[model samples]
Target: MDYHTIRPHPDLSSIVKCYWTLEVPYQNDAQRQLIVPDGCIEMIFILGDDVKRFTSGDEYIIQPRDMVLGQITEPFYVLPSGDVKSFAVRFYPYGFSNFVSISIGDLVNKETPLVSLFGNEVATALADKIRSAADTLERIELVDAFLLERLITKPTVDGIVKRTIDAIFSTKGKVSINTIVNDDSSKRRQLERKFLKEVGVSPKQLGKMIRLQSALKMLLNNHTGSLTEIAYESDYYNQAHFIKDFREFTGTTPKAFLGDEGMILSSVFYKQD
Candidate 1:
C-alpha cells in the first residue's frame, strides 16, 4: 500500500487543499476500511478496479469511476474489489460550492458522478483527458485548467460561510458559533442557512469534524500523553467527551484506533496532514 499527497497550484491554494493518490495491491482477503468525516469534499478518479461502499450490513454499491464525494457526516466503510489506484482533489469545506450550482447539502454522504455535476459531455471529455494523461503532473495540469475555466464565472463562496470556517480552523474548532456571531440569534441562523447550502454541514458539525481531525493527528502521531490529556489539549470537556466525539466521527475508540488494521489508509492521511 502507498499513499501520497501533493500541493495544489498556488492559484487554487485557497479552495483546493491538495491532490492525493493511493495505490494498493490486490488482496483476496482485504478487509473493509473505515472512512471518517474530515470536513472536506473530494473530486475522485478511480483509475484501477472498482471499489464497494457498504451501505448496510453486507450490502454495497460500486462507486463511480469519476465522481464527487460530498461532505460525510458519519463513518462508513469501503473495500477495494481489486488492486487500488486513485487520484483525487481535496477541497476546502466551502470550496466545491464555487464550482457547481447544486447545494452542497444535497450531496452529503454519497458519491455523485462527475457527469451528474458537470454534465455528460463535459465530464466525459474531462475524464478521458485525465485517463489518457501521461502521469500525475499532467493530470494535475488538466484539472487545474478545467477548474480555472470554471472559476471564471462560478459564484464565489459566501463570505459568512468562509469566515466561519476560517474561525473554526484557526481555533482548532474550540471557538463557539455564539461567540463568533456575538450571540446574535439572527446572525447565527443566517450563518447556519448559508453553511448548509455552501459547506454542506452546520457550523457546529464542521467544528466537531475539525476538532476531531486535530485529535486524530495527535493520536496517530503518538504525540500526546494520554486520552485525558489529549482530550484537554483538543479542548474537549473531559476524556469521556473526547471518546464520545471520537466514536461519533470515527466509529472507534482512541485506543482501539491506534493499532486497527482498518485504519491504515486513514492513518496515513491524518499523519501526513
Candidate 2:
C-alpha cells in the first residue's frame, strides 16, 4: 500500500486542502474497507478497476469513476475489485460550496456524479484530462487548471462560517459553538443555517467529526496510551464519551477498529498523513 498527499498550488490553498493518491496492490479477495467521516468533502477519480460501495450488508453499487463524495455522516464500506489506484481532491469544510449554487446539505452521505455539479460536457472533458494525464503531477496540474477556470468568479464564503470552521480545526473540535458565535443567539442561528448550506453539516456535527479524527490519528500513530488517555487528549469528557463518539463515526469500538481487516485503508491513509 502506498498513499501520499501533495499541497495544492499556493493560489488555491484556501479552497483545496491537498491532492492525494492511493495505490494498493491487487488482492484475490479484497476485504471490505470502513470509511469514517472527517468533516470534509472529496472529489475522487478512480484509475483502476471498478470498486463496490456497500449500501447495506448485501447490497452495493459500483462507484462512478469520477464522482464527488459529499459530507459523510456515518461509516460506510467498500471493496476493491482489483488493484487500487485513485486520486482525489480534498476540499476544506467551507470550500466546495463556492463552486456550486445548490445547498451542500443536500449532498450529504452520497456520491453524486461530477456531471451533476458541473454540466455533462464540462465534466466529461475534465475527467478525460485527469484520466489521460501522464502521471499524478500532470493530473494535479490539470485539476488545478480546471478549478482555476471555475474560480474566476470566486464565491464569497460566509465570514462567520469560515471562522467557525477554522476554530473547530485549530482546536481539534474542542471549541464550542457558543464560543464560536460569542453567545449571540441570532448569530448562532445564522451560522447554523449557513453552515448547512456551505458545509453540509451543522457546526456541532463537524466538530464531533473533527474531534474523532484527532482520536483516530492518535490511535493510528501508535500513541502509547489507553483509550481513556486518548479521550482526554481529544477533549472528550470521559472514556464513555469518547467511545460513544467513536462508534458513532466509525461504527465500531476503538479496539475493534484497530483489529479489523476492514480498516486497512483508513489505517494506511491516516498513518501516511
Candidate 3:
C-alpha cells in the first residue's frame, strides 16, 4: 500500500485541500477497508478497478475512471476491487458550494455522478487529465482549472448559507441547530429543506461528520498519539465513548484499523477540517 498527497494550488487553496493518489498492489485476500465518516467532499478519479461505497445500509457502485463524491453525512465503508489504484481531489465543505449552484447541504446524503452534475464530457475530461498527468502537482493544476471554470457558471454562496457555514467552522462542527435558527424554528426548518436540496444533508449531520473527520486526521497523521488522547483532543467525552462513536462510523476498532494496510490506504485520503 502506498499513498501520496499533493497540496492544491494557491488559487484553489481555500476550497480544495489537496489531491491524493493511492496505489495498492495485490498480495492476497485483504480485509475490506472501513472508511470512517468525514465532512469534506471529493472528486475521485479511478485509475484501475471500481470502488464500492456503503452508506445507510445501501451500496453505491463507483465505476472505474471518474466520479464526484459529495459530503458524507452518515457513516460509510469502501472496498477496492481486486487491485486498488485511484486518485482523488479532496474539497473543503464550503469550497464545493462555490463550484455548484446547490447548497452544501445537498451533497450530504449521497454520492452523485459527476457526469450528471457537471456533464459527462467535462467530468470525463477532468478525470483523464488527472490520470494522465505525470506528477501530482500537474494533477492539482488540472483540477484547479476545472473548478475555476465551473465557478464561473455556478452561483455564489448566499448570505444565509455563508453565515451558517461560518458558524459551523467557528464551532469546529459543534454548532447546534438552535444556534443556526432565527428567532423562530421556521428558519431551522427552511435551512433543513434547503440543505437537503443543495447540500444533501442536514446542518447538524455535516457538523458531526466534520468533527469526526478532524479526529481521523489526527489519528492517521499523528500516529504517535494515543487513541484516548485523540478522542479527548477531538472533543469526545472519553476514550470509551470515542471508541463507540468511532466504531459506529467506521465499522471497526481504531487499533485494528492501523494494522490493516488496505485501511490505511483510504484513511489517509481524508483532508483535515
Candidate 4:
C-alpha cells in the first residue's frame, strides 16, 4: 500500500485542505477495512478497480468512480474489489459548502456521485479529464481549475458557522457551544440550525470528532502513557468519557483500535500531519 498527501494551491488553501492519493495491490484474502469519521468531507475519484461499501451484515454496494463522501457520523467498512488506485480532495469541515448550493446535511454518511452534485454533463466532463490526466500532478491541476471556477461565483461561508468551526479546531474540540455563544439561547439555536445546514452535524458532534482525531494520532503514534492520560491530553474529562466518545465515532475501544487489522486505512490517514 502507498498513501500520501499534497498541499492545495495557495488561493484555495483556506477551503481546500489537501489532495491525496492511494494505491494498494490486490490481495487474495483482503479483509474489509473499517473507516471512521474524521470531521472532513472528500471528493474522490477511483482510478483503478471498484470498491464495495458494506451497507449491512454481509451486504454491500459498489461506490461510484467519482463521488463526494460527506461527513460520516459513525464507522463503516469498505473493501476494494481488486487493486486500488484513488485520488481525492480533503476539504475542511466548512470548506465544501462554499462551492455548492445543496444543503450539506443532505450529504451526510453516504457517497453521492459527482453527477448528482454538479450536473451530469459538467461532472462527467470533469471525471473524464481526471481519469485521462497523465499523472497525479496533472489531475490536481485539473481539479484545482474546476473548483476555482465554481468558487468564483459562490458566496462566502456564514460568519457564525465559520467562527464556530474555527473555535472547534483551535480548542481541539474541547470548546462548548454555550461558551461560544456566551450562554445566549437564541444565538445557540441559530448556530445549531446553521451547523445542520452548513456542516451536516451539530457543533458538539464536530467538536467530538476533532477531539477524537487528536486522540487517534496519539494512539497511532505510540504516545507514552495510559489511555486515561491520552484522553486527558485530548481534553476529555476522564478515561470513561474518552472511551465513550471513541466508541461513538470509531465503533471500537482505544486499545482495540491499535493493532487491529481493520484499521490499516484509518491508521495511515491519522498518522499524517
TM-score of 2: 0.97
Scored by CA lDDT, what does every candidate get?
A: 0.92, 0.91, 0.69, 0.92
Per-residue alpha-carbon lDDT of candidate 2 for residues 121-175, written as tens digits (9 for 90 to 100): 9999999999889999999999988888888775489888888889999999999
Against the true structure, what is each candidate's TM-score?
0.98, 0.97, 0.77, 0.98
Note each model's CA RMSD in angstroms. Answer: 1.1, 1.1, 3.8, 1.0
Better of 1 and 3 by TM-score: 1
Lowest-sum lDDT 10-residue window in model 3? 264-273
- For model 3, how does the per-residue alpha-carbon lDDT over 185-272 read when each residue is reduced to its tens digit? 8888887776665555677777766666677777777557788888888787888877887676666677876676657544656633
Question: Candidate 1's residue-wise lDDT over 23-133, tens digit each?
Answer: 999998898898888999999999999999999999999999999999998888899999999999999999999898889999999999999999999999999999999
Error of 1 at 99 (Å): 0.6
lDDT of candidate 1 vs native? 0.92
Q: What is the TM-score of candidate 1? A: 0.98
Candidate 4 runs further than 4 Å off: 153-155
Q: Encode model 4's per-residue lDDT on 18-102: one tens digit a residue.
A: 9999999999988889887988999999999999999999999999999999999987899999999999999998889988888
Report the poorest 10 consecutive residues by lDDT, candidate 1: 153-162
Poorly placed runs, candidate 1 (over 4 Å): 153-155
